[model samples]
Target: MIGLIKNEFMKLLLRKKVLISSIVLGVLCILLCLLISVAYKFTTKEAQIESQQYIIEVFEEQLEEAETEEEKNLAQANLDEAKASLEIIKNTPSEDDPNWRINVEETINILKEQLNGLPNDSGEKEEIRKNLLEYQELLNKDIRPMSEMSPKGINMLGYLIAFLGSLFTAIIVIIISSDTVSSECTPPTLKMLLTRPVKRGKVLASKFITAFATSCIVIIGIEIIASVIMGLIFGFGDPAYPMVAGTDYKITTVNAMIGKEAIAVFNSSYLSTIFSVLLKSLLLQVLYIMAATSFFLMISTLVKSSSASIAISIVLLVSINILKVIPYVKPVLPFLFMTYGNTTTVITGEIKISTLSSLPSPIFVVLIFLAWTIIPYIISHLNFTKKDILV
Candidate 1:
């Protein structure tokens, strides 16, 4: 059994298609980095200038609406602070400006002072305090910021893996899984395997195990390469940077939520060790990808045509994802495999959840995933072992 599994793994590694897939994944990771850099270059400076101007306008309106002495005092103070921040934004000419760091530090200090003036017992006030303190730390340390307002290194890796990386892994799995049985059938390898003393069920199980192992390697390899390349360019950053996660379990960097940190403290640990946390958080997403892979493998085994299986898998996955957005259909489809595929969101306890009463527990999501994984493989096993192979 061990030798059979090893042979199956070797067959995958030796394939030119697998080599091509790896190259494609690498190139895509490089492109993700370039795209992020370009976006940062175009948006950050303009956003700073425009955002300060917007804040100034907003404070002026609030001052006009103030109806009491305390309200007026708070409004006037905020308005004065906004005007000062706008001046700072204008004085710092470029990202390279030495004054830029000084101006940001000063602005953060002002925010910290403002945080203390708020009602101490208010939940909203405490949220504001954390945001101020967080930005104060970021600016004082001169941490490189990205579009996600996270430290550049961790943000680049985490965002890439969470969004594009998940899709890329799914594509690779589909490619490999769709080819697993059909490729063998096309070349009469299935018949040769059947002639051996091994039962057909064992042969099928070997293929499934090999595909699962290959998928694990593909996911871990892509993330490692992306992390190393981006870290080299952007600097690995302080592992202790802070972040706030929303109710949906999605993360928001301290820099991103500069003025509003109402999120619970569950993300405090994640903030302190973002790089490691990101990798660990992504394991939930990886399991989601694996569930999809198992489905495709089952399709390939039962269908016996690589093209048909690949096409069906793509369409089904896409359709299910799109269906998740429909209010009417989404709630009714909890049992659907795709419903549990977003384990990241489920585990995060998002505000907008799939469950009717509230967000489903992570354990519940895991059980659904287990059902998805076990049922497909069982069906595939039964189908492959009983079906007559055409030579």
Candidate 2:
């Protein structure tokens, strides 16, 4: 079995498609890093001041258009808070100044004041309250805020994993796996291999193992290359930056000025460092790749033409993602492995589909991925072993 798997791996490595894919992936990593570096340069302290100014303008307009006494009060409060924040930004000596802690405390006080002004049932109240709590926690812990545009390698990696990694990995894995079985059938490779006294089941198993292993290697290799390039461009950055975990929202009745009203209460309790979250995300990504590979293999087994297999697999993967945002289909999203494809979001408790009554536990989502891996392989196994490939 080991020898057969090795042989399959060797064949996969020798393929021109594999070589081309690797080059393309590497180039993509370089391009993405360059793009992020450029974006980081634009997020300067002055840009932040400009953003605050824009917010102040928006609030001023809202205050002007307010018709009711309550609306006017809310808009005035918001305008005042925006101006205060803008003043703080203007007065700060530098982005890295130690006075940031003091500024954050001041911001917390401003948010608390805004929160108090908001009516009990107002949706904005909950948002302000959440920010208030987050700021308070940061001040209490004395942890510096990690800017999204920090130009750090680890931050870049996090952004890539969250935004681009999953989609790229899925497309590459689908292309490779979808061709694994069906491509063999076209070149008399299946007949040639079966004549070597190997059981059909062993042949299929070897192909499955090789595809899964190759996809994993390619994904991890690309990540490493991207990380190294980013690190070289921008320092590796601190691994101890705090990441919020176990964030969730619940709908509950709150006592309003008029009466009780249902509102969504947002909460996040656990905190893990960036390194820890990245580690967990990487592990989850591997599981997702396994499930994706197995599912595509099943498609390859079912479809006789390699091109058709690839097309069908890509369409199915894309369609599943599209379905995720459809309100009518959201109820079934928890049962789909694609819902957990963005492992970073899953780890950081950032999955916020409003249609989901509650988020699935991580363990449960892991089981869903495992089921996808095992069930599809079983289907492929049964079909491949029983079917006639010599025709």
Candidate 3:
């Protein structure tokens, strides 16, 4: 058994394809990072347009720059007289308080007038829009949507990362799942391996371990590298930016909602950010590939050609989408192998999730998926050890 594991390890290590796959994953991570950065820029621009909220400094300057001496005097008198009044009006304006409404209208008109005065060049507008859209996205900070001046979420970026990551990962899991077993079963080497002094179970175990390790090294490596490059380029601070989708903005941010000290309380380290992303993504791919490794390792024992395992795994993955929509099967939700996969966005701390909210705790969710691997894996091992390979 020990000798078999060693041989399998050497085989996996020597494969050039593994090395190439790792390299490709790294390059793809860099590309993913660039895409995320672009998304940040687009989100910021759209948020600025929809919010239409001007900073106090800009409003203050406008107050001093009204056209004539009388305009300036009126503005100065209002600034002194209505400091509290305007702010109250800003916060809760009555329809009768036309003064509050007029002030806001004047400011917006001035801003628009300035914007219209700029050249109609597309390049210039794009540049200005991009500049106005600057926002900060931190690694592990709470994110809340700042749209509509209320509480909601803008979980799109984190979810988008998880979704896209989950997608590619699911595809890779399919490819490797069947390959682990079928490749061994169909090859000339399969017979020799089984007939060796070693027990059949060890050989099966080796397949699972090798493939699991390969997948971890590949998928985790890709996400980590991509996140680091992207995080650095976009810079980290706070995920206070709003994502404007269609006509609404979704925001997530740490509740500096309490007091002056809350600002410092919300800060998260770079490693925390990386770790959150890593764990979330790792949790996703691990459970997915683990399920694949187990089922296929069993299939490897049954099939004559590695190609069949590959085909079967791909078919199974595609079938998962169809199964998710079935009403009758929804009751079996937690037990489904596909159910354990996406733990990434759940880990981002960006959403307004309660700690106790998931159908099961994240810990419970992981344990269930793990059973998919362990239960089948042990059975395959026992079958491999006890059964004759001559068939």
Per-model TM values vs. the true structure: 0.69, 0.80, 0.57
Candidate structures ordered by TM-score, highest first = 2, 1, 3
Instruction: Estimate the overall C-alpha local distance difference test score of candidate 1.
Output: 0.64
Best by lDDT: 2
lDDT string, candidate 2, 254-332, tens digits: 4464332224343333666788888888888889889988999999998878888999988987898877666568668
How many clashes does each candidate structure show, in the order listed?
A: 2, 0, 11
The Cα error of candidate 1 at residue 82, in Å, is 10
Evaluation by lDDT, superior candidate among 1 and 3: 1
- Candidate 3 lDDT, 1-391, residue by residue in tens: 5665677667766766666666765666556555545555444433443333334444467676888988778667655654554344353312223343444344445445555666643223423332222212211232322322211112223433465454556555545545665576555666666677765666677777877766766776565555544446543323444231111112234346621111111112122333345445566566767776777666655555777866766676667656755645544655655654555533443221222122333455567667888887877777666546454
lDDT of 3: 0.50
Estimate every model's Cα lDDT from 0 to 1: 0.64, 0.76, 0.50
Error of 1 at 124 (Å): 8.0
Quote model 2's TM-score. 0.80
Q: Which digits, one per residue and each the tens of the lDDT, describe model 1 over residues 1-391?
A: 7788999988998988788987887787777778877776645657777888888889889989999999999999998998898776665434434566665566566766776676644444545554555555567566533335332566666666655533566677787777788777766778788888897777877887788778767766676677777778876666665543333222223464452122333222122335444644577666666676678888888776667878888887678767766646745565665665434445334423344323345555566667777889888887787655544
Q: Give me the candidate number with maximum TM-score.
A: 2
